[model samples]
Target: MVIIEAKGLTKDYGNLRAVDHVDFQIKKGECFGFLGPNGAGKTTIMRMFYSLVVPTGGYIKIFGMDLNRHASYIKSRLGILPQDNNLDLELTTLKNLIVYARYFGISSSKSKRKAEELLEYVGLTEKAHVNIRNLSGGMQRALLLARALINDPEILILDEPTTGLDPHSRLNVWNKLNELKEKNTTLILTTHYMEEAERLCDRVAIMDRGKIVAIDTPENLMGIYGGNLEDVYLKLTGKKLKEENNVENNKS
Candidate 1:
């Protein structure tokens, strides 16, 4: 039931070594998270998972198939939400989903139905015909989630899925994620929000400067570190003051 296996995964950008050799495994239907400050390589690893960035060394296997060998097939089963909003601004909310589904070769008729269902799933049914630019930030975030689910992917990969939304919007996305987990979907994500990781992830890997420094469940980390998930993150990554400076300087 190992859905994802990374053995000494590494990535490099020109002279910069973004992701150092790291190993991890994610089980089927489990939620696995990567937590780190800016430029800690969390986003780099996320890109590697979806085959956006080829590794400089090591390998990754999704569904027991090597990512390098079966990237096309593997990507078909993955739902990706990058850190930025990449939705087509010129398109309506419904068209955004339909257009994305077309990339997966989903039939137009079927994509339309799927789009409607996903909008309802994310509580955006009323905004279906609205242009992307007209929706509130929360609504756009929900549309992005809906679009990611259009292909009904078995594995959902997210990077800062709920970064800028208000508390209510964040909670709404969290509920939808939990619902997906209940239906046995594997979730892989990277986030700076420790509470989001603690709430949604079964286990999290804390990365620092391109390496996993600690990997464990939120409760276990908290138990050992003696504070909330945020405290555990700061403790494992570095001193709070120094870590803050590092995060600011490393923003990518």
Candidate 2:
């Protein structure tokens, strides 16, 4: 089953087009990746999927329903981990999860139980009672991930899901996400980490200047371009050494 279908998807900010004539289809249980530099409109495409921003022109269908008509239902089935750290700092880790779970109408008892399980799953059980302020950057990202999964939605839209994590922490989250994939969850991801996409995504779309420049399985993309993802990116989009260094710096 095709979980998502988009054609001619476009988004504009005044004179600048943030996403231009994008098109893609994601299978029900496959991992689809969106890769690009900062401000390449990857986030804009993601926001469109979750109906956070209305598109200027396009057609989208989620779960066989029109995006325009079924946005509420579609959003209800989406789990989103935005790039920004938007966790409620005033609340404890457990409270943070429980409160967000309430948005999906989960019962208090069930939310608490699921919160406990996720805290354990994300390796944050020991810090569940701690305030968000005291947690490390990586721990907070993990908690946000756990919060995104509290409802067990059919689709997960992850934006740089491992952005703030150490190598060990990032690996742990990767394993958990792979487990979810094994259970047939559709995932849409946006990230600057080519290796992460290569490891996790069944296929990826490369975007530049609000447009999709390429789309294929990671291996095929490499083969067609005669190099690795970074090479392909550089060839197609023209990599800047400073930008490359910045990505490396942030990943560490």
Candidate 3:
């Protein structure tokens, strides 16, 4: 049930390599995590998979189709919740959903019905008519989640899905993600939060300096590294502050 296969994937930005030759596979109905600190190129790799950014080299296949040749078809079955909120501030919560559904070619009436169901699913039914500007950050996150589901995609790609939320809101989002997993939805998530990755991912790939340094289950990674996921992450990545200071000193 391998839904995604990436072989020797690489991306370069001028002289800088954002994603170095990397390889990975994600199976159907599994929660896979990409973990790393800033500038690790996790997002760059994920963006390549989604076809937002073309790979500098190598191949990517989704659902048995070549990513480069069938990007539109692949995108049709993929749901993405990017790190930043891209919602239209002037639109109502329901309107946002309706607009997204149209991209999938769903009829207006059908899209409206689906939007309502999604709003209810995300506990935003009460705020269906509320403008995006008025909703709390948590509510907005929930709305994004709901919008991602409007097309009923088989694969969900979330980038820092719960970033910048309160504890309760984060929990709510996590619960919803779990529910989706129960329904056999395959998920690929990128996050800096070790706890979130540990809690949600069946397997995590730790990337650093544009390459994958480790890939294993949370428990195994922690066990092998002699501590929790955070400790393992730090051990693998070293201290970011020191790296930053070194760069600063080099400049001086």
Candidate 4:
């Protein structure tokens, strides 16, 4: 039931090693989370899994198929909701979903029907005809989620899926994600938000400085550190006061 298996995965940018010797496995129908602070190489590792960026070294297997050997076949059954919204602004909310569906070879009629159902699911049915430019930030995020699900992908990769939304919108997204998990979709997500990871992930890998520092269930991780996840994170990756002082002095 392993949907994703990565071993010795590494990625480099010139002399900088962004992701180094990481290994993990995600089970089918499980919610897996990558939790890290800024510049922790979380996104770099995610890009490798999605095959957007080829790995400098190691192997990535998605659904028992090698990513390099079956990139097209793997991508066909995968969905990605990146940190940035890539919706075409000129199109209406519904049109945006329809266009993405076509990329998966979904027919126009079927795409339209799927789009309508998705819009309703995301509570944006009334804004179906509204241009993307006019939708609120939360609405756009919801639309992006719905669009990612249009093709009924077996695995969904989400990068900071609810980064800038209000509490209600965040909760709505959490609910939808839980619904998807209940339907047996494998989910892989990256987030700096400790609470979100705790609520959504069955297992989490904590990365820092191009390495995985810890991996376990949120509760177990917290128990090991004798504190909440946030405290544990700070303890493991403490900031250097001297470095902060030097940066402040340089700015002045």
**What global local distance difference test value does model 3 have?**
0.89
Score candidate 4 by lDDT: 0.89
Task: Estimate TM-scores for all models.
Answer: 0.95, 0.94, 0.94, 0.93
**Candidate 2 lDDT, 1-252, residue by residue in tens:** 788999999888999999899999999999999988777898888888877888998977889888778887777888999989999989999999999999989999999999999999988999999999999988988898898899898999998898768998889878988999999998899988888989999999988889999999999999988777888888888874238548757886
Task: Please report, in order, the local distance difference test score of every candidate based on alpha carbons.
Answer: 0.88, 0.89, 0.89, 0.89
Which is the winner by TM-score between candidate 1 and candidate 3?
A: 1
lDDT of 1 by residue, 1-252 (tens): 999999888888888889899999999999999987777898888898878888899998999998888888999999988888999999999999999999999999999999999999998898889899999999988888888888889999999899879999999999999999999999998887778898999999988888998889988999999888778877776645246645675674
- lDDT (C-alpha) at residue 216 in model 4: 94
lDDT of 3 at 24: 95
lDDT of 4 by residue, 86-149 (tens): 8999999999999999999999999999999999999999999999999999999999999989
Clashing pairs in 1: none
**176-241, model 3: which lDDT tens digit per residue?**
999999999999999877889989999999988889989999999999987777788778878542
In terms of TM-score, the best-performing candidate is 1
